[model samples]
Target: MQRALLIAAVCVAAVALWLWGFGGAEHVTVWAAEGQRAAQNAMARGLRSLRAGDPGALTALLGLCFAYGVSHAAGPGHGKILIGGYGLAARVPLTRLCTLAVASSLAQAASAVALVYTGVLLLNWSRSYMQSLADSLMAPLSYGAIGLIGVWLVLRGLRKLAARNGDDGHGHDHNCNHAHGPTAQQAGAVRSLRDAFVLVGAVALRPCTGALFLLIITWRMGLAWQGIAGAVAMGLGTASVTLVVAAASVTLREGTLARIAAGPATTRALGLVEALAGATIAALALQLLLRAL
Candidate 1:
């Protein structure tokens, strides 16, 4: 049973890594990317209408922005990898993980608004220049942070596994890591607010292009509030998709823990998942960085 559960968990992780690591099944890639692009196009058109100030345009714009956020998140270049990767490794509660995803997505939107606002109002830089600045400076920093976090996760997972192995005949509490549920038994091992902040920072580093474009349009059109509201809509859309990914990651880990009867084996399996997730994240970040450079 232990081996079977471990195999299942490993298979789930493998499939996710394959699909997201750049060279998954070709059809999956095309369909997902195309869908994302379509959503982006729809969002662009919606922005135009909202800017025209027709009756009910504000509500319509908000709806469209929400939809766009969902699709945009579904596409790529957000922080799906980070969210998903952390999900695989951490034994954290799925609910908390989902909440973090929401926070991170909102932070990303806020970053976009702050950047564009600073450029247009405070610095007097034009739209084109702001976009360029984000593309060049902010994008790299975001990718770099993601890559570093991935490496950190990988190292942490490896160390955990190694220390577990070194336990040898020590006969320490194997279930020490199972610190969940009520009471003082809540193991803080699986949860880390620092990690949440880092992951949020990773996504927030790069402002979304759509947010930048839409904001610039609204600002130029003298509808700054619309731009702010639209940005929030985008964040909500992104949070929805991100939460789904985070949920999946949590489910897999939980399943593995539940199915594997042996406490020690469960810990080992989790470590393996964490290690794989970290490697995938690092690889994806490097790929993005290289392309950006």
Candidate 2:
């Protein structure tokens, strides 16, 4: 009964979060209602010009969306959404979770750029066949990336679950637990580099629908290049905010005492946190991919 209640709670929380953060994506009217008047006016102007085949109008819209998309997607709030599970882990410092958030946000921005640029290139290469090709290429790439990342998250969750089984059940292993930041020299080493690379890669493995949406809208508007430009801008904006939050979280985690608490009870608590966070992340990742496809 407890397990069932927990599952239900998690599901409820997930749904609420998704709706609060991402509901605009599903309901076009929501965007129309929330967009700044200035932005809406600008978009209206740009659309008119584009419809009339004005090159300048096309250029402006492309630039606007790309910038907006990148900034919005990489923003710190979005990072919170992506790594909230990690932050909830008992054994993990909120700061460490924040770093993961920052890493993921950056990865997401980079991936958005890649996706946008690919769309631009395909449109240019295909000329008259731009629309069909863009949908075909972009959808599969985005959904496939999401699925692959979902699988990885599930595997990671399983590993965490297995590790928990090996614990001595004494609570937090206080004697062995030390939350020391690596020395600068140690951070410069090859192992550190590998870890950094893995973090960045793992964070970016999931595809963002925001980038895909921009690409599609831009293509349909007949502003392929401008669409890509908008994507890049959006990515940068998003990354800036998320990275800062992550960095702040890291700084706090490095100094926190709550991370070092001991006993089997503590250990079990931490293990449960890890398991729940991992499972939540894995489930959401899969759901995103499935919905996208």
Candidate 3:
């Protein structure tokens, strides 16, 4: 009874934390907005210094870009949403999830680079047009992809629950044949890898506006290489925050699971957690998509 009560309390705490993070409490939202504006202003100044051929300007600009990334990521964003949700919903290894966070951040940066260069060099598209494309088309597509991920998680959880319901008391399926095939662990690893790719893709589809701005300004100033480097540095900075979120979510999830007694109850709890997390993610994605559209 005590264990159950403890588990309930932990679950409640987790949900509260999630809500506080995602729901954008007025104070937090105001602080984040202010920080972002300040960081963006500093970045613009750094770009001007670089353009003036000032010594050490490159270093300062890169530093500002990194800071901008950190400030931007501190706000409620899709990357955090996806990473935190997946961490809670799935039994992904901590190292793997952290890797995914970094990969997704870097991929997002790369997408910005690709989009800017492609538009400016090949298509002769203006900055406003490119930004509009990203905001209008890519944003919706990314949200849709995230929604699909949520649906995938929901279905996976439901299937696991169904399988558990069909399990005999011996912890093995009674209808199973002893046929040679890839082990369940191997299959799971494959699926996890695929999911990681999808997560990265979803994030990459929506390039960071800051990155796009940096790239365009640097490109106009004939510092394309520096822009690339700054974009990468910014990605690292963003990854730092997402990594923290990933770690926290995993720790919370594992801590909760540890509190549960090892039995069918634990299995059911895992399924329920996954389903609930997935449902929340899907709902959030739907809301974002609607707003974007």
Candidate 4:
């Protein structure tokens, strides 16, 4: 009874911490905001020098952009949360997970530059309009997609749980002779790529504010090339941060799974945890969606 009570207490505390600190969009966190501010300062300085024809400033600007990327990534954003949470629930390869992180970050940088450049140069849309679309439209869409992914995860977990329960009586010879439905491992792998795609889309669709700011300033100053370079550097830095976090999550989750036995109790526990993670993610995302609407 004590053990159960203790576990319940810990779970409650964890959920509170996540929802209050890690999960809340309102609490963007002081450190991340500071990093963002520092990056903005660096970008402003870099833009000023580049406009003054000091070509040497470009190198310094790129370095600051990278720093900004790292810091921006450290913030409480949907990308990091989704990646880390998925890593906790799924058994994706570390390399593949890291690959997705890098790709998604770069995609965000690319999207910001692409949208801005295209809007300003080709479509003749104002920068304000572009920013508005990113905040009002793209962000909500991404959050909505994240909620849907959560639902999918929950459904998959429930199905696995049901399958295991159904096969409880035939546990002895069913595996050796009678073919069963998809094993957990097989089912997880089948959707691994699909999950990666959804997460990538969720992250990529949201533009980085710093990247957009730099692009707009540089474009106006006739140094679009420098802006592009800096944006790439920032994306790389963000990817680096995300990769480290994801690697840790993957290692921890895999290690935990490795220790669990094939017994029904353990299997049931795994299913519940998976479903709970999905529920947490979905609830957080839904909160954001509601706020947006």
Candidate 5:
């Protein structure tokens, strides 16, 4: 039954990949772009209604903000890349990964709020200046941080491979009983928490442009609370999409692991998969960083 389940999961994953590879991605991109344009227009209309003191205008505006976020997240973005890559490379629990995805989205929204408020109220910076800072400075910083994460993953994989090799060279029997020391376990836990922080921080360093625009406009219109609420709504909407990605990545990874024979071979395969995913992430992040610069 377990084998059957694994096979089913693998088959489903394969079909999804096939569809995504054969123009589905492009179609999704076009649809997302259209959704974004429509949402933006609706938001503008909603804002005008709010200015006119129309009933339910605030609700409409918040709904539009959420829709805008979903549409924006559906497009190609580095956040997805980072989340998906980390999910594929790490042996984390699905719930934990999904939680991280949501946290990162919320953190991103918070970053946007912090930046806009700090710039407008404290620094007395213009919208153009804030936008330029995000684009020119924050973007490259985020990409560079993501690149470092990829490198860390690669190193982790290498260490696993080296440990496996060492075991083999020492003629260690797989069936031999051994236990990890408390120090080692504690270190592993600490590393896991650190990795989670880094992943969220890297994504949060560059706030969503749409959120920034909304915050600034709302602030100017004296709807500061509304803007902050809408930004949180948008974050939840974005989390909806990232959660799906997290699920898919976990399912695919688990399915692959289930198919592999347990033992040294499985360990080796996992290491290789992690290393390859990390390498791809690093290469893409490097390219993006260069483009941002």
Candidate 6:
């Protein structure tokens, strides 16, 4: 059915996002040594300018947005994921899911920024040891986190379809929101400033390449504080697109997407999409693991 076909398309998009966003050495023009030096120099430059005040933060924010947008648009792997997620968006209430996307994106971008800032203190504290520690840990950890995300998406999709056996033909019409603890109503929807801040805090945990790359560059530059700017910038950049999409999803009409977004029949049909994404992630993860080994 047409719905089933859409699943395949969605799966391809997911795999593509990874490739586009953070996939491969081929896209990198800087040789390892050159990159290392550039990073070191940039960090040095960044530190001297810290006294320049908010400019560094402003520039960092712009740089992050530019970097993330470019990566999202041009990175084949990441592009695929965006497309695939969009496809899924067609099936679900975009507003709800967009919140999740924003939450995740912000988390990823913020984490990257935080790590970059930490690079300075880390370097100052132990130099060679810290560098060694980071080198040994960062790549594997990033790859593992990304791979886990892919797995989570596949599983979530499957679960949506599994809940009911009624719908078939590829997509189901279901609204799926899985959360731990209590329901929203029980938690109270009151608008408290502390609650808002807590929500914002929770939103900044997703892993992001922009933050990661910025950190790497800063660490190499030896001006670790620059990384914090980069992180904030990255978060803003991701939010630019994500927040717009979320708002649009909220305002948009809830159409047939809700119908085909679920059920056992749709689950079986959507399997190929899941498989493709899984295979791509697994392959990439294996390659990284092997290289590490």
* Backbone clash pairs in model 3 (N, Cα, C under 3 Å; residues 3+ apart or in different chains), count: 0
TM-score for candidate 2: 0.50
TM per prediction = 0.83, 0.50, 0.86, 0.84, 0.90, 0.46
Q: How many residue pairs clash in each candidate?
A: 1, 27, 0, 0, 0, 37
The local distance difference test score of each candidate is 0.78, 0.49, 0.82, 0.77, 0.83, 0.45
Which parts of model 2 have CA positions greater than 4 angstroms off?
A: 1-67, 70-81, 86-123, 126-230, 240-260
Model 2, 1-293: lDDT tens digits are 44543554455456546755877335533442344334445655776677788868766875655445444443222244344444443234444545555566556656755655565565443332443443455434444543444445446545544554555444775477653232223322332344345545655644344555555566767766665565555555555555554443333322231343444334444445545555655566566445545
List, residue by residue over 1-293, the lDDT tens digit for candidate 3. 55654565577567657657666455555776787788788888887888788999989888877887887788767888899889888877789889999999999999999999999999999999999999999999999999888988888778767766656345666467852222323322534467778999999999998899889988998989999999998898889889988887777777777677665666666777888889878888888899999
Best by TM-score: 5
Candidate 2: RMSD to truth: 9.0
Question: Regarding TM-score, does 4 or 6 come out ahead?
Answer: 4
* lDDT over C-alpha atoms for residue 214 of model 3: 86
Question: Local error of candidate 2 at 140, Å?
Answer: 5.3
Error of 3 at 147 (Å): 0.6
**Cα deviation of 27, candidate 2, in Å:** 8.7
lDDT (tens digit, per residue) of candidate 4 on 201-288: 8887888878888888889888889899989998998998888767766655555555565456556655666776677678878887
Which one wins by lDDT: 1 or 2?
A: 1
Measured by TM-score, how close is model 4 to the native structure?
Answer: 0.84
Clashing residue pairs found in predicted model 4? none
Q: Between prediction 1 and prediction 3, which has the larger TM-score?
A: 3
